[model samples]
Target: MQKKLVCNTLKVQWRTAKLLIFAQNLTMGTIMAKESYSAVLITQGEHRFYQLAMPSDVLSSCTFVSTRDEDPDKGFQRLLDKKRAKEIATYIDSGHGTIPTSIILSAQEICGLEYDSRNKTISFEVLSGSFLILDGQHRVFGFKLAETKIRVPVIIYDGLSRRDESRLFIDINSKQRGVPSELLLDIKKQADYENSEEQLFREVFDKMNGDPNSPLFGRLSPSKRVKSKISRVTFNAALKSIYPALTSRTPGEIQEILSEYLASVRDQIIRNGGDENILLNSITFRAIVSFFIHAARRVKDRFGPEYTIDNFDVVLGPLFDNIQIAKLSGTSQSKILDYLEKHFKGEFQL
Candidate 1:
C-alpha cells in the first residue's frame, strides 16, 4: 500500500507541482514552496503561538487526534458533525462567504517547526497527520469538502502537554462567550453603512443615546446589558418595522423626531404619576417605536408633513391619557403592541 501510494504521489506531482508553487506564491509570503509554512510568532504570558493563514486543503489534510481521559493515546476534541461541515462547505462555495475566526491547532515534535527570533516568524514542514486540531474541526473539514479554496486564519501552539491540550480545548469550548448579536448589528451599521436605512436608524439611535437632553440619554444599551437601559436588539427590531417611514428621513431629523416623541411620552407618563422609567422597559419602548409611524401618519393627516415633537405629542395624547401604559411594562412585546393597537385604532381619539 505504501509503495503504491508513493508511485501515485510521484505521478500526480508532475501535474500538480506547478499549481502548488503558484498557490504558495499567491498567498504573498506566508506559504512556502517546499511544503513549509511560516507565520509571525505571538507570545502571551508564558505560552508561545503562531498566528497564520493556511489553505483549507492543507489544514484539513492534517490529522485529528481525540483525547480520552482513560486512554492518553486518544485526544480531547468532540466528534465531528458532518452535517455542520457540509453547511460550512455550502457557505464557502457561496460567492460572498468568509470565515474570519482562527482555527486552533497544536503541533507535535516531529513536524520540524522552528522560530526565527530575528524575523519573528515560525516556519514548519507540512507533515501529513501531524497537527492536532484543538477547535474548528467542522470548519477545517468544511473546507476539505468545499471545491472553492480559501485561506483560513489559524493559531498553532508548538509545544503543549497532553494535559494542557485537554485543558486548552475545555477552556476554549467552555470559557469563551460569543459577541452579542446586537453588537454585531451595531458594528455592521458603522462599518458598512452605504446609506442603508438600518444604518441610518442605528445612527439616529446612537444620537438619541449620546445626547444629554434626549429622553434616552445614556439609557440605550447597544452591546451589553445595562441596569436601566433598553437593549439595541429590541430597538433594532422596532426600527425594522418602520422601514418605509425611515426611507425619507435623515439621521439628524429622525433623531430629533424620536427624541421629542420620547420626551413627550416621558412627560405625559410622569405628570400623570405613571412610572417615569416605563420607557426604559424593553416592551414599552418597542411598542412606542412601533407606534411611531401611526402617530406620524395621524399628525401628517391632521397637519401637513412638517411634523414636530408636539405633533406626535398631541396625536399620542389619547394613548397615554386613556391607557395606563406604565402598568403594561412587564408584558410581552407582542402583547404590549397588541394592547396599544386596540386602543390606538379603536377606542382612542387619535
Candidate 2:
C-alpha cells in the first residue's frame, strides 16, 4: 500500500513538471499541450524507446537556462529596465519565429552577451529543468522593456544534475573565442557579485595572455584580450616604479600628480602640431615620460629637493646621457618606467 502511494506521488510530481514545460510552450503560441507530450514510448517491432515530442516552438524557446542561483523572473526584472524590455519585445515580434542562434548560443557559449542592434533576439534552452542565463541579462531586460514576447530555445533534460549544469555553463563561457579583457573584467565583476577585490584579480589574470614571465603578467597589455591585475599592489607598484622621486607623497597624491602630468603632456602634444592620436599610439610618449621622471630625480639628488618641471629642461639631458633613448624601442612600458625611476634616485618635479 505504501509503495503504491509513493508511486502515485511520483506520478503527480512528474505530471506537474510536464505541465509547467507545456505551459511555457503554450504561452509562446508554438504548440498546445495535447499536441506535445513527454516520456511517450515508441515501439518499433520489438524495440521500445522513450521519446519527447517537442514542437517547432519548443525548439525555438531560446531563452537561456536560469543559473538557479537566482530567480529568473525576479533576476530579469533586476537586470533590465522597462525601456529596454520594450525594445526586446519588438525584436521578437518582427522575427516571426526565426531568431539568431548566435545571439542565443553565443551567450550560452561565451558566458555573456552584448546588445546588438542588428540581432533582435537571443534564446537558449532550459537545462536541468531550469533556464540558466549564460549571458545577456540586460538584453533580456531590454526585451521585457519593449513588451515583446520572446520564445527562447531550450534543451530539456531529465534528472539534470547541478554539477553537470555548472560545468556546461563554465565550459560554454570559457571557450568563447577572441574575448576582450574589458569583457572578461565585466564577467569577473559579475561572477564575483559581492565585488571582492581579490576575485577581480584572479579573473583578470585568468583572461590575460602570454606566459607568467611576460612583464605584462600582472599589468594591462596592449592586446585587446588582456588586462592587468589592477590590485592595490600593482596599482601602488606602478606609481612607485614610475615616479620613485615622488616617494614622499602618498599613493593618492602620486596618482593626482601623474594624472596632472599626463594631462599636460597630452595638451603639449596637441599644441606642438603632433598627431595626438599617433603620439598616444606610439611608445615615444611613454618613453619620454619615463625619461622625464627619472631625469628629474637625478637632478634633485645632485642638486636639491628644490628641482621642478621648469628646471627639467636642464636636468633631463644627463639622465639619458649614456643610454640611447632613441634605441629604447620595444622595451616594456613598465620596465622603462622602472629603470627611469631607479636611475633618478627618487628626484622628480611634476
Candidate 3:
C-alpha cells in the first residue's frame, strides 16, 4: 500500500510538472480541474468522502431566522436597522466580485450561518453550532441584508453554549468606541469567578486596567502609572512602617476603616465648594489616613482594640480640623502627615 501511494504521488507530480512546462511554452491558456475532478481524486481510496460546493451565483440561498421568538431579556443582542441593513445589502451586492473568498468565509463564521440539504438553502439555524464572532459583525450583517445569495465561512460545534457565546460576544463588542463603564462593571460582576474582597479588588483592578470601557482603562493616573506611587500600597506600607505595634485586621474590617476615611475626606472636599483638584491631586488624604491608622494602633496598644481614633478628641479631632490649614501652607503632604504623627507621638503639642 505504501509503495502504491508513493507511485501515485510521483505520477501526479510528473503530470503537474509536464503541465507547468506546457503552460510556460504556450503562454496562452492553462488547464484547471473542476469540483468533480477534485471529488474523484479525494475519494480514490476505500474511504467515503463528502464534497459540498456552492456556486458563486447560488451562494445566498439561505435565510436568517431569530432563535428567540419573544423579546430577549438579556438586552445583549441588538436589532438591525432598516437603513443600515439596506446599505449593507448594497455593499455586499456591489463588492462581492472584489471581496476575497477568505473575507466572505470570515463573515459567515462571525454571523453563524450554515448550509442545509433538506431545506435546500443556507440558514443561520444550520450554523447554530458554537462559534465566536472574532471581528467584523456589522459588515457581515450588512452582507446578509444586501445580497440575495451570500457565502460565509463558518465553524460548527456540537451545541451552543451560553458561557462560551457570551465570552465571544463580550470580546467582539468590547472593541467598539465609547463603551460605558457601568456596562463593563456589570459584566465583570457577572463574570467574576472569585467572590472574596481581596479577589474582588484584584479583579476590579485587572478589569479596569484591561477593559476599554473602564474609567481608568488606558489613562495613567500618577499613582496607577508609577509602581512606587500607588497610593493604596504606599499608604498601607507607611502605616505598617510607622506603627510596628499594630496587628493585621480582617478584609472586612480594613474595608470599613478605608471607607470611613474616604467618606470623611469626601465630606471635607464637598464643604470646600467641591474642588476636585484639591480632592484628587492632594496626597494629603492618603497620608492623613495612614497617620490616623498609626495613631489608632498606638491608642489600641496603650488601651485596647476598642480604643479607636474616634474616641481621641485631642488627636483625631484636631487632625481633621487642621487639614485645611496645613493644606493652605503649600507644604508637602508627607511632611504634614509626619508633623501630625510627631505631634501625636508627643514631640510637640497641637
Candidate 4:
C-alpha cells in the first residue's frame, strides 16, 4: 500500500509539471495565447450564434477569404475595400466615433472553439487563419488601420456551411433598406450633430415650413414621397447654393431676406394670374435663389443697405413679363438657373 501511494504521488507530480509547461508555452505565445471571451448565446430556429465585443486588433489578426469572379474556387467574401477601410480609420481617429453595428464573422471548425454553456463563455487558442470574415470585410481592416484601440461589436457563427455563408452575405447586402434622407435630417436636428452652417440652413427651413406668413409655409414635404413642391432635400440644396453669399449675415437676417424675396416672387406670380406654386417648384426656386445672389446686391446698392420686398419687387418686375414660369418644366435645374442669370442681366442691363 505504501508503494502504490508513492506511484500515485509521482503521477500527480508529472501531471502538474505538464500543466505548468503548457501554461508557459501559452505565455510565450507558442500556443498563441489561449483567449476566453464572454458572449450572449442567441438561438433562433436552427441557427445559433454568439454576440460579443472583441478588441479590433484581435480581429485584425484573422484571415480574410474573398471569392473572385476570375477564380471561382477562391473562398467566399467580397474583396476588401481599401479606400473605405482608410476612411473608417480616419473616422475612428477623429475621437468621437464608433461602429455600433456588429460585424459578422464565421469561425472555421479548425478554430477549436470550446464553449462553457453554464458560464456563457468561449475559449479558443489563436490559430493562423482561424476566423473567416463573412461580412464587414472593410470594417475589420479599418480597425486594423486605425491608431486607436476599440472594442468592436462582433457576431460570430460556427459550423455554417460555405453555401449558407455566401447566402447570408447576399441576403445582408440585398435585403436591408438604408435609412431615408428625410429621417436622417430630422434625426440630425434632434441630435444637434452637424456643423454651424448645416444647422443654420436647417433652422431656416424649419422656420419657413412652420410660419404661416412665409411663402414656404406647409410647402416642405417631411417624407420621401413629396406631396408639396419643396422636399427637405431640395430646400436644403437651394439654401446650400447660396450659403457662401449669406455667410456674412446671421440666420435671422438670412431668413428675413429669403422670406421677402420669395414673397415678392409669389406676389408677382399672383398678379400675373399665374399659379404661385409654379414659382415655388423646386427647379424654379433654385434658379430664383441663384439669381438673388446678383439681384440682392443691385437692390441693396440702389435702396442703400436695408432692402425690402418692394425693392426686390422693382428689380424682379421684368421677370414675370418676359419669362413664363410654366414653360420652365422639364428643363434641368442648371439650365434654368443659367438661362435666368443671362435673361436678368439683359432685362435689368446689369
Error of 3 at 13 (Å): 11
Better of 3 and 4 by lDDT: 4
Pull out the clashing pairs in model 1: 66-74, 66-75, 67-74, 67-75, 67-76
Whole-model Cα lDDT per candidate? 0.78, 0.43, 0.43, 0.78
How high is the lDDT of residue 244 in model 2? 43
Q: What's each prediction's TM-score?
A: 0.59, 0.29, 0.29, 0.72
Instruction: List the candidate numbers ranked by TM-score, top first.
Output: 4, 1, 3, 2
Q: Poorest 10 consecutive residues of model 1 by lDDT?
A: 28-37
Worst 10 residues of 4 by lDDT: 62-71
C-alpha lDDT of candidate 1 relative to the true structure: 0.78
Residue 71's lDDT within candidate 1 is 46
Per-residue lDDT of candidate 1, residues 1-350 (tens digit): 99999999998997699778878775654444334456878888778889888888888776465735534575566667799999999999996789899999988876667777776666665655468888888898899999999998999998898878887889899999888877777788457733575677678888888899888887888887676888777787778887778768788888887787778878878767888787877777887788777778888899888667777778778777888755568578777777777787875454
Model 1 error, position 297 (Å) = 2.2
The per-prediction tally of clashing pairs is 5, 34, 5, 0
Colliding pairs, model 3? 60-149, 60-150, 62-122, 89-146, 105-153
Candidate 4: the clashing residue pairs are none
Q: After superposition, how far is residue 350 of candidate 2 from its true place, in Å?
A: 17
Q: Tens digit of lDDT per residue, candidate 3, span 1-350?
A: 99999999999999999988988755532322211111111232332222334332322222232222233643244554567756766766775433343211222243344444454343332222212333334445555556456545432222335544444456546755654443343355456633454243443344434556432344323233243223333333334443333335543444444444444444444555454334333365456545556655654675575543244433354444544543522447677677766655556554
